[model samples]
Target: MSEIPGLRSAAGEQQGRQIPPASLARLTIYLRALNSLLAEGIERVSSDELAEAAGVNSPMLRKDLSYLGSYGTRGVGYDVQYLNSQISTALGLSQDWRVAIVGAGNLGRALAGYSGFQSRGFEVVALFDADQLIVGTEVGWLRVSPVQDLATVLGRTRANMAVLAVPAGVAQSLCDELVDAGITSILSFAPVVLQIPDHVQLRKVDMATELQILAYHAQRAQDPDLESGPRARAAQ
Candidate 1:
């Protein structure tokens, strides 16, 4: 790992800063870009270069990184390894996250087999399904367990995080079960609104909604009148 210069003292100031949602999202992108830079054996990165790597404007990247305290020098830019560590700590990536995937369908199996999750500190410890035939099957290194044993498997694996790749119809019930079984953080790929306890953090990824948004953007790009509209510019 490369060393970061001059900003070690500012590390303490990053705590308790309330980064806006938009900035929080961008920080993840910056982290990915920084990781790529590190893999290339690059040690230092200028704000402009880093921003371009992250696919964001320099000013926006700077603004996003402000929540974590400035670590870049006037001419030398940021230290890649140090910045990566700082971002990782900020995002709780330093801690071990055991993830259990509910519904060992195609999506669940794919997510379980993803190499990126393990590289980023998320371990897929368990996989569950309602089908008896699928339950005993192996997905990656993990054997799919029966959904009836959800709580039991979670306890055995000491899982703290969960992913719901189940259908929308059964998503809510499974989510409730996960919360009841002591899981606190959940990422749901199911396209439905779930009622979770306030203490449980839930994040929903609706692929259909994302596709619809993409369709809207495509339509706007093809239409001369829509292309010049204020709404289209705002969307961009």
Candidate 2:
């Protein structure tokens, strides 16, 4: 594993600086692209190629990578193995981060069954839901448990993060309960913004918002005004 400098925790009254969320997210996409390249036995890649594969602009990709210091060559591009190692270290993928999933609905079940979580640093250690009937049911290798067992499961498994896939109506209360149980890091799939303490880290994934964005772009694609700019005459 490569050494990730400045990623260590800080002492009292001194909160450590974190990588920007956008950069962190791009790092994940870069990691995935790098992994694919490695699997294909490709040892070198350019920023333009990587950006295309990762669905990002070349300049933005280069800028995001610059946050971790300059690892790419001026003209040649980046070394695949070295870049992968740097990103892995920076994202804490070199260490194991146990995760617990709250809510055992379709989305939750899908998440539990997904293998990507384990491939990265995240490990799904527990599956939790409030419904009594759903509890004790096996979803893949994990057996569902009641939400009340959150604290116990967290301590027993030493999970530092949680994912909330509950309905929008109950998501906030569930998030509060998770925070109270000492789970600091959260990934919420709910649409509503959750209220958590400063110490807690919350990342929201709003499906509705994403769908709305997609719809906006779809609508724009059908607009004659938007399309006219491509072949329009310029004013002299």
Candidate 3:
């Protein structure tokens, strides 16, 4: 596989170097901050200001932006539009990615109708369901197809990624089918650990886990003494 073009400076050329995942995540956050700044007609921004906008420290933001080969001009700071373009290209947002949603349930339906995906270069080309009842039904502009037609639909639509929103029990099996169908990237909403091939990129979003985490913080805020309780120590 070829190295990502934007991962290196034009002069530095660190093609063989590995980028830390944390840095990559921060780059996306930086990209979002740039987008908001651009929309507000903000032109040039210093590293400290950008870091404040992104809710991260200035040094870390600089470090993350450095990995994208974009070091702001000394004294003048970064050009907002140019920095945004650099980050976009670095994150592969310069190209449109056709996506497929597996499972025609509630979560799948919501994701399918989300307009934000289209603006960000994610085009949902196909929706699939194992249940025959929803196979021919419409989810937006596209009609739902049978899961059995995954490979054919993927090839026909040229979809490179898929979103798995099915039940935990069927997520792995459906994931296997997606991989077999040549869909390499997947964003899973199933609250379970899915086994995927090393070649395929898989990301999981557990809503329940996030809510539970929030609940824990809320509990701590409500009762400061809870952290000192015997039950908390025993559990820990």
Candidate 4:
């Protein structure tokens, strides 16, 4: 387990920092690629091979891995298992993360049923909903708890992380409750922006925004104006 320099928590755990946001995101992709290779019993992988698996260029992948001070040998390539462990440690995947999801809607239920969360160290300990009819319903092993008991349930389940799958209108109130109950990390799917205290870390996943971006790219790809550029003009 190679330790990442200058990346440590107050408790001296391997914490992630200094890496740029884009590089950090790529590290996760690389970790996923490495895990797949490990599953296939691949002992070593060259930069080009790993890059292709991760959908990144060789030079870009090497640059991202450089943040962890991991530069493979010139010809021997990288040890797959070793590199996987290093990235896992750097991303703090070794720690147990218990998640409480607010809103027992379709999305929440789907998220709770995702087995990948457990495989990645996040345990979905609790599910919550504002509706009385939805409460007491089972999503996986978890019985949907009422949102009214949000704070109490969070404390009882010892959930340090939360997912907000509620509507934008009520997202803020639920977010405040989660923060008050000592949840410092939150992943919100609400279409509205949430304001939180400096201590809390909030990550919003706006599906609408992503869809709009995709729409933009799709439109551009089909544009006749783009086809009229140098290559098409030369063909004519």
* Top lDDT model: 1
TM-score of every model versus the real structure? 0.92, 0.84, 0.85, 0.87
Greater-lDDT candidate between 1 and 3:
1
lDDT of 2 at 117: 86
Give the root-mean-square deviation of each candidate in angstroms: 2.2, 5.8, 5.9, 5.1
Candidate 4, residues 60-144: lDDT per residue as tens digits?
9999888876446665788887788778877778788899999999999999999889877899999999999999988889999
Answer with 1 or 4, whichever has the higher TM-score: 1
Model 3 lDDT tens row, 60-138: 8888887766446776788887788777766778888999999899999999999989867899999999998899999
User: Model 4 Cα displacement at 46 (Å)?
Assistant: 0.9
Clashes of each: 0, 0, 0, 0
- Model 2 residue runs over 4 Å out of place are 1-18, 223-236
lDDT of 2 by residue, 1-236 (tens): 22323423322112135778877878899999999999998888999999999988899899888777677777788889878977787776778898899999999999998988877668899999899999999999899989888788878989888999999999998899889889899999998878999999999888789789778766776785546536543211
TM-score of 1: 0.92
lDDT of 3 at 220: 75
1 or 3, which is superior by TM-score?
A: 1
Model 3 regions more than 4 Å off: 1-12, 226-236
| Residue pairs with backbone overlap in model 3 | none
Selected candidate, larger TM-score, 3 vs 4? 4
